[model samples]
Target chain A: MNLLLLEDADFVAADRAILRDRRLHHLQEVHRAQAGDTLRVGRLDGAMGQGELLRLDAGEAELRLTLDRPPPAKLPLTLLLALPRPKMLRRVLQTVAAMGVPRLVLLNSYRVEKSFWQTPFLEPAAIREQLVLGLEQARDTRLPEVLIEPRFKPFVEDRLPALAAGSLGLLGHPGEHPPCPRAVEGPVTLAIGPEGGWIPYEVEKLAAAGLAPVQLGERILRVETAVTALLARLF
Target chain B: MNLLLLEDADFVAADRAILRDRRLHHLQEVHRAQAGDTLRVGRLDGAMGQGELLRLDAGEAELRLTLDRPPPAKLPLTLLLALPRPKMLRRVLQTVAAMGVPRLVLLNSYRVEKSFWQTPFLEPAAIREQLVLGLEQARDTRLPEVLIEPRFKPFVEDRLPALAAGSLGLLGHPGEHPPCPRAVEGPVTLAIGPEGGWIPYEVEKLAAAGLAPVQLGERILRVETAVTALLARLF
Candidate 1:
């Protein structure tokens, strides 16, 4: 873990935190940390600073924290993605979180197999676990809000328009459309489709919802790669 | 598989080919393809075209080949990566190929774990398998050439200079260096470090080899994500 993330449960006092879970194991094995060493640390949804290790043991580690710096700024974008397969969903969650997405909508498209929705990876607790892993990887603290939309039509027609009203709504699809914009000036609402891509009717519906179609050339990238590439190109 | 890749052994005649492998199973089950159905096809390291399924059975499937179209152009870049752990190395190879990296040098770094060099994933056949999967994912034909450099100091000082001579040699390091350039016109040579990043002396040696350091903001990304992000931003 890049930053030792601290939840309220990890704290023993206002300034002292006790890590007894995986963090403790990571400190012992991966870091080979010792008492008196200072490490990067962040409080959940709070500030990031340094922690001076006061005590280290196999059972737990105690640190005196001095959280002050705010977490890194999130992207001024809301990512709407077609829910990938169970295995891919986990990685995408980590990728989205690590890339600093502030909000995400796990959407459905016609091409999304019916079985994908039944995956336990969609569970809230499971989702949170992946997001936390991402925060640890990126050394951030704030958790991105995630929304699930198993039905495509209602979410796009009823909620997306209002949610995307002030943003540069764009659809990441393969076609003869304009290339995805670079270094966009303001907020963006980007929707990416499933493996076989969005059907014609769904694209039309999304277009009516203000998300105009865009392309990233001919090579079809995997969902995770596409997410990283699109976000990198946009910002 | 987006494209049915054809090797020379698959060709039965000047205009025909046979398949009795994973591609055959994919046609039978995934595609549920029938005789006379047309599928996208590409020759290994050659042109891409459409193939008409002439016969289909559990045992074998035959196609009439008419190769003509060229594969997607590769990136005007060479990627130099500190060899990741075996699992990440496989994914990175696929990512590199899918993103159209023409060449890759899997160099060693000070922070790279010694055990990483012993992975069977580094074997030629194993590497080719991942590259083929990448080509299939991206619907490209040509394979990226991979070079292994087990010794860091000698490779950086003795050979990297000439190798990166005319390109915009850049190192993806996390520091106060200039941000990586975007949409450059010429070729590029990018070196991405291992998980914990390159040591100071290693960075110095790379600098002397003509690569200057560049940052990708404060958030640290996983090696695979960093590769995609850097490539997307540069291209």
Candidate 2:
């Protein structure tokens, strides 16, 4: 548990901030927090502080906190990824968020199988859960904005331009090309393919749209690996 | 398992191969293979083959195999990484092998916590097990060789020139002035950092030893991400 994040309303009471359900569960199970114990806590849109557990019970807990300052400014990076397998999608979202990319655009691609779109795991709440895990890992309070585009053409032709504005855009593919640039200034937009990878036509289209076809090397990486690798090198 | 991996000894008799233990468990549980099922199989140092289940039972299973052609060539690159956290290490080794980087050098780095060296997962057999998963994922039978360097300085200075022979050696770091190149030919040796990333002095020593400090981008990626990203762009 990096930081215990709470909502604005949850922090409203002056006497003691009472956490009854999820927070209490976290305290007991994840943190193994006890009475008089201090856990790293953060308020919504507020600074990070320690929460002193004044009292604890099976169901609820009361904490006395001292909020100080907010988290580090998040990097201005947008990840444009093809929707992956359901379980993998969750990992990707959480991992991306944890890495400090503020925005994620889950787009469509050619190699993406048809069944992926039908998964119930695509629900916004499920995606949120993954994002929350990401936030917890990085100790960041701000939730990254996630956008889904089931249609490939519309996303790339219409929405991607504005998002790529003032950004260094790069596409990851495995080929004998230049390595993906390091230290790109301004906002950055990175495109990664699906399991089987972006077909030649799709690569051409992306290249025509100003996304450079850059590679890390000759090895073919999984989707999750490619995304994480791009963020690591670019950020 | 993406690809069913078999060994020369696995081909017991002229026409029959008996699969028992873990492979049988996977065939039963994961693949749900029944009698008459055919699976893609690879022979160690031999060729990709087809396995036809001739009989099945709790004790062992009999398979009729048809050996054909060699597995795909491994990716034309090599990787040298700082030993990451054990949890991340499993994924790193697995993914690297899956991508077909035939060799791995797990070196020590400045940000690599001292305690990490104590992990039981660092054992050769344990590390090779993880690489097997990657090989299975890629459907390739040849296992990647793994090397360990518990000490950082001596390895980078003494053994680097020989290991890096005929191969471009690059170090992936976040802070260095310029960015890393995207793609290059011939064999390559890539050195990545741990979770906390590479300390400056460590990067300089490698750079002075004919290694190039390549940047992925402005964002700091986790060690796992950095390795994959550098491999994608550099190899």
Candidate 3:
């Protein structure tokens, strides 16, 4: 684990960071980390540092934090993603967080099932949990700010244009468009559709908001693969 | 299965291309497909088609291939992936195929364990099997081409530069750089690292070979998550 995250205020106040979380369990059970094992640590949405284990128990562990290193930078990109199935949502959140996209706009789409948005996994804590797992995997400390847009039209017509400024933007569509370019060295906002993809009207609306519709290939990728492929190519 | 894929010869004078090969087993055992059920079918390296019931035997089944439409386009992108563990290798191949990346080059890296090269999944038929699953998921027919390179330096220094031409070339690293752009358009040749990521010297080599060392964030993502994230940004 890169960042041994701590949430308990008591430990943070005592100049101590506790590994008494699910992560600690992971280290103990999966990694089998020993005391003085020097785990990489971070405070949520804060700085990154190291944690030297001092004590341990079945449920809790204590360590001292040493913030000497700066956290890695985040992507200057914001995601306008259609809410995905719960299981896929968990993976998407974790992957997005791990990749360090600073913001996410989980919007509604035509093909999206109404029930998908109601999934309990969409709750902030659950989202936070997935982000934590992603951050830990990437050895990062800062958490991306996630936003939800229950209404697609209002968000696209009213808010998206404003957010498009200084941002290289595009819409992921399996239609007529050149292939996606590599990192263009600036802020970017990308919008991806639900399972079947953005309806033509949705694509047109996003285009009006300065998001260009781009094709990945002839084959239709699953939402997850398309998301990953788009991010990787942009990188 | 959304598509039942077959070889060209498996067509012309062949049965329904019901994929009696292992796919039939997949249908019978995994999907529990019955005689009358219709399934998606495609000619390998060709367009998507459909199949219907005919006759069945202990080892084989015969049906009619009625091809009415062409498969979706193959992804113009190519993936230069560092071989992952076999367990991950299985799913990744399927996902990449589904993404419609027409070509893949799995190379060795410093972080790659020697044992991973010996995985049974490296067998040709085994790999093709995974690709088929990916095509079925996306309802596409084209099969992706996979290439394996055990040597890193020769492949990167000699073969990759020309291969990456006219393509957005990216090297995924965890360091300082501009954020990954969204909906990158154009031909793309993406390079990703092995489990522990490319060592500094290797990253430098890629940089020397015209790869732009890009960061997803401060966080280090798992290979699978990284792949997914990268694709999302690129598309």
lDDT leader = 1
For residues A1-235, write the lDDT of model 2, one tens digit per residue: 5677777767647525888877789889867888999887776545677789998899788889887767657777888888899889987887787777788888888878889999888898888878776666666777888898998887787778777877777888877778887656778788898876788887877776678888865445567776766765665
Best by DockQ: 1
DockQ measured for candidate 2? 0.23
Clashing pairs in 1: none
Ten-residue segment with the worst summed lDDT in candidate 2 chain A?
A: A7-16
Score each candidate by Cα lDDT.
0.95, 0.77, 0.79
Task: List TM-score per model, in order.
Answer: 0.99, 0.67, 0.72
TM-score of chain B of each: 0.98, 0.93, 0.88
lDDT of 3 by residue, A1-235 (tens): 5667666563655468665567778889966887778877777767777778887779878788886777778878999999998999998887787777889899999988899989999999999999888888777777888899989899999999999888888998876798877756888899989877888888889999999988776666666676767777776
Error of 2 at A138 (Å): 7.5
Provide DockQ values for all models, in the order shown: 0.94, 0.23, 0.47
Put the candidates in DockQ order, highest first.
Answer: 1, 3, 2
Which CAPRI category fits model 2?
A: incorrect
Q: For residues A89-148, what per-residue lDDT tens digits would candidate 1 score against the true structure? A: 999999999999999999999899999999999999999999999999999999999999
Model 3, which residues run further than 4 Å from truth? A8-14, A57-59, B1-4, B7-41, B46-87, B99-126, B137-193, B198-218, B225-235
Worst ten in a row by lDDT for model 1 chain B: B179-188
Better of 2 and 3 by lDDT: 3
